[model samples]
Target: MSVTPRTHVRTTALVLPAVLAAALGACSSFDQGTRGIADALTLYRPEVVQGNFVSKEQVAALQPGMTRLQVRDILGTPLVTSVFHQNRWDYIFTMKRQGVEPQRYRLTAYFEGDTLARFDGDDMPSEAEFVQRISRERKVKVPPLQATEDQLAKFPVTPGAEPASSDKGAAPSGAQPALSYPPLEPAR
Candidate 1:
């Protein structure tokens, strides 16, 4: 049986589209499979920290009758400020670190006529406690609060009298002179 030019053309036309479709489908599926494997094998996922991080010290500083601005200064701008609840401000913080359970904290501040009436939330961790927690979760050792006696002995002890200054005319060691510059022209 002789295969004519017309027959050859028809066969090629029919098989080309099917081959192309299969190749495209396989490429997409292969990419998806590889993506899944890559996701599973990923070792370093960037930690996600969202919203205002209010520490125990800041929360403890909060006092009743303080203005909204004062509360805002202590704890950064609330994450959830609802239009419906104008007087209520919600500060929510979420931290998601790879290989560790997510941590979430929420604090709701109720205002009565522009004054902070009350605040309700979880017992916040102090700065030191928070650092220790993070270090523990990350499998890192927390440094000792006080230096060892041997380490402290390495440094020379200072006398009660102040250190002699080489140049009396020069500014004090820790003093910083105020800087001033001319203001720029206002934009038109």
Candidate 2:
């Protein structure tokens, strides 16, 4: 009976400390996390970022009287264009990276004769920004061209080798029809 009480006392003593240890362990982890966060706050440092950038204040100085060559010297070539309007040109300069000053420049040009008649400008966004805006604008997808059958064909395109296809659908080689076809439709 005495041994049973002593065993029970020892077991209770052992279990009580373990229960207390488990309870305290959780609080210690929270303390550790708080200390870790404090250490991170003290040791952490912010970084400075940089990117290719330009300012309009620089381009605004460009004047209407400036020639094509002079404009090229001041600003780089256009980014986008249509072949039909050679007179109109667009200039773009962009910057990338976060936590740093933005550097970007853009100019849309309209030329009269040889002189630059007018130009408009704004800051250029990063490549990421450019892609995001472009996506919103909805562009059609076009795959690059592979070689065509003509390019791969061993046969020559000479007149004798290839028969000409007339705009009108003519009958293949055969005896002439005994009856004439109906008359064509008249112009409106």
Top candidate (TM-score)? 1
Task: List runs of model 2 lying over 4 Å from the truth.
Answer: 1-53, 99-105, 123-188
Tell me the tens digit of each residue's lDDT in model 1 across 27-64.
Answer: 99999989989987887778777888889999999999
TM-scores for all candidates? 0.62, 0.33
The lDDT per prediction is: 0.87, 0.65
lDDT of 1 at 139: 55
